[model samples]
Target: MGIRYVSYRVVLLITKKLGLLKNKFPTKPKQSTFITLADWKDTKAKFLIESREKLNFPKTPNKKLKEETLRILNGEICFFSYDWKNIGLDYNWITNPDTNYEYDIHLHWTDIPDFKKENGDIKYVWEKSRFAFLLKIIRFDYHFEQDNSEFVFTQIESWIDKNPINQGPNWVCSQEISLRTFNWLYALYFYQNSNALTEERFQKIMYVIYWSLQHVYNHINFSRIAVRNNHAITETLFLAISQNLFPFFNESRKWSEIGTKYFEQEIDYQIYKDGTFLQFSMNYHRVVVQLLTFGIALKEIHNQKFSKVVYDKAYKSVQFLFECMQDENGFLPNYGANDGALFFPLNEYDFRNYKPQLNTLHKLLTNENLIVNDDVYDDENWFLSNIKFENNYVPLKRTYGIFSFDFGGYYLARKQNSFTFIRCGKHKDRPSHADNLHLDVWVKGENVLLDSGSYKYNTSEKNSNYFTGTSGHNTVSLNHASQMLKGSRFIWFYWSQAQKAMWQETENEYVFEGIISAFQYLNPKTIHKRKVTVSKNEELWNVVDEVSFANTDSMQQNWHYNSDKIQFHTIELQNDIESYNSSYYGLKEKGEGISFSFNKNITTQIKYVEE
Candidate 1:
């Protein structure tokens, strides 16, 4: 780290600390003066009163979607692909369903810790408050022509009555507050004409919205300066859109100006020139894509325009994720942190499938489709688009090739039915995982050699160490230790730097070679250099890992795979071990792996065939 960067970080830390001190004495919003729908019509804000008529849904309700919606209506909440049933009709907004622990609702937001010191992960409490599932409920009503407005508004009232502004766990993070605010706005716009939206309920909802936006606006610096990643993007974009949607608010104009400027700047800074996200996580990238879809679609509807760089970066982002996508089912490599976040779930696809979000953005950008097949996911497109939804099948503009995203440190060797993804990068920003030089291979839509995904952020020390450390990745580790020294909670002491990284492609084969300076805590001169060769015709991969100047007693090579499917050669498999593989958050399954100790170098070959 340079002195200048370190000094900047220190300044940010001090600023955030001072902000928190100010937050210790918080004030609440007073009663709201009622405004009717006619009053809103008089304002210059773009009232989406026609959204219900503009949206085009499927002819019939999806059975599976109906079932899930019914389950939610029955008081069951789905978190991280698991259902917590019997949550009761009056669901407490500040309680962790998993641990049955209720956070003190009277405490100020700043007093609440991110992780509870005693019982559970605070994310459990924050998940339902995100209001993502409420969007699902509204979709149900919209698709089935069911009058669930009473149920929906009742629940919204329940949440508001429970979680007061600037109080309890629900108000802890500004990003979560932004998501909740966005989702509520969606519901409000959809049900604006319904009889269930009485004047009394409208005043109550607007009061909450006004105060919530105030909280996010006041604490925007925490995300913009201290944590300059997707959080900043989400919160800033919310403010930008809210300006046009709710122009009646006092701070709407100023918030819109600042929000639009920073939101565009964040898109340029966080997404690399080659379209890879700085966070290095596939799920988080998808989150950004969804946010972009929301922002761009709304701007296009209102005939507003962002800077050209925003659209250019959005197009490049779609292209990059398109290259990484495995198939039409939209399974990308679980390469980085997987928190199982699907910001807008308008269709009944699996959580891991990303085609819906990607296809929506592509259509919004070019007025064309990225994937043309039998399956249709036009719910999100319909809600966001000004014109009616149409499935105009067009051929994909970009084809597969041996591509290198140098800025983001990802290289890909893609064929008709196979993909080889390699990670070798120097961190200009914070990295989520110690996964430098990690290799992810997929064949025929099956991940043959894979990454042990992040199970959960708040886990045991051993599990946290394994999931975020080098052992969880398919790479070489010195003395069975992580590639970099782990610090307190998402901090690394020594950042890994990649050197001499290059990719080459010939008529028959693709080759990649990279060197990463790692494990300096063990020895100052330790280095791990890796070379990968892929034969196009033979469907084979050969990896050679070499370690130099390592003073450790032993070096180990780790590989995780589905033992029943993949065939490994050119190396002796010793010390068969049981490892955990988590394709989604808060879930894990035991998998098989091999740990081979070598003096300084090792080689392995992998091949997959149809059964």
Candidate 2:
């Protein structure tokens, strides 16, 4: 680290210890009072109210969606795929249902202890506070032609009554606050015409929105400077878009201006030129895509324009994710740290499916669909687009070849029914996982040799280390240690850098070769070089791994696979072990994998076979 960055960190630590950061974000004023929309001089609330008519919501209820909505109505809240039954239909906003750990609602958000030291994960408490389920309920009500505004408004009122401004775990994260504020706005627009949306209710909701925006604005520097990733993008985009929806607020114009500036800057900084996100996670990248969708769509509605760089980055982002996609199902390789965050899920698709969000942005940018298939994912498009929903799509012609994103350090080898994905990157920003030189293979829409998904961010040391370490990926780890030195949570001492990477395609086969400087903590000379070759006609792959080091004698090569389909051919598989695979957050299943130990080099052949 440079002395400048070291000094910045030291200064931030001192300021935090001195309660300077807390002083910037003040508590809600005791005399804070709600004002009706009619009382505002310049209000765009009517535009939002009338915008509901343009929404192309599903006319009939989806059975599964209705079931989930009913469960939520019956006091069951789904947290990271686990249903916590009877979390109270009104909902307890400050309690972790998993551990029954209730946070002190009276304490300032800055006073909350880190979840690692506490009994439960703070995310579990923040989940319900995100108010994502309210969007689900609103969608359900729209589909069934039923008015659940009374219930929805009651829930919002209950949350406000419980969580004071700048207090409790819900207020700790600016990103979470942004998400909650947006979700509330979504519900408010959908229920604007309801008799249940009385003047009193509107005043209360708008008051909370005003305060939430202020909170995010005040704490914006925290995300921008310290946590410069998706969190920064989310919070900044929230402030930018909130200006359009809630112009009646006093600081809306100034907030939106600064928000627009930083939002664009963040997009340029965090989203690389090739559209791979700085965070290096498929799910986190999708989060930015959704934020882009929101920013672009909302700006268009208000007849505003962001800089051309914004559109350029959005286009590149769409193309990057599209190239990584395995098939029409929109599943990408679970290649990086995934906390299972889907900021705006407007469709009924699985969390891994990227078609809805990706296609939405692609259409917004180019007026053409990225996926020309029969699978319809128009929910997001309907919500974001001004035009009515239509199944007709002018498919954008995309040429698929060996695609390499040099800036983001991703290489893709495309064949008829399979593609090989590799990650070798120099970290201009903080890398999420120590997974340089990791490889993922997909055959016929199924991941044959896969990257083990991130299970959870905060967990037991062994689990956390396993999921984030190089051992969980299809790569070579020297001395059974990660390629980079793990520091604290989400921190690495020495970042692995890609020394050399290349991709080539001939008439018969596609090839990729990459080398990364690794394990500087052990020896600066340590390096891991990997080469992959895929046959054009046959479902076969060859991976050669070479590790050079000063002191280490043995290097371990790991591969995770769907044991039912993939078969190994060249290398002898030793230490066949059962591992945990978590495709979704808060969920893991037993998976099979094997490791090969070699002194200096090893070669492995993987082939897909019929079950």
Best by lDDT: 1
Off by over 4 Å in 2: 1-5, 32-35, 38-60, 81-86, 373-375, 387-398, 571-573
Error of 2 at 538 (Å): 0.5
Q: Quote each prediction's TM-score.
A: 0.94, 0.94
- Candidate 2 structure quality by residue, lDDT tens digits, 479-574: 788988888888888899998999888888888899989899899998888989988888888899888873687778888887577877655447
Clashes of each: 0, 0
Writing each residue's lDDT as its tens digit, candidate 1 over 88-164 gives 78888888777888888988777687764464778778887887887778777777888787888888888988988
Q: What Cα-based lDDT does every candidate model obtain? A: 0.80, 0.79
What lDDT score goes with residue 148 in model 1?
80
Provide the lDDT at 426 for model 2.
Answer: 92
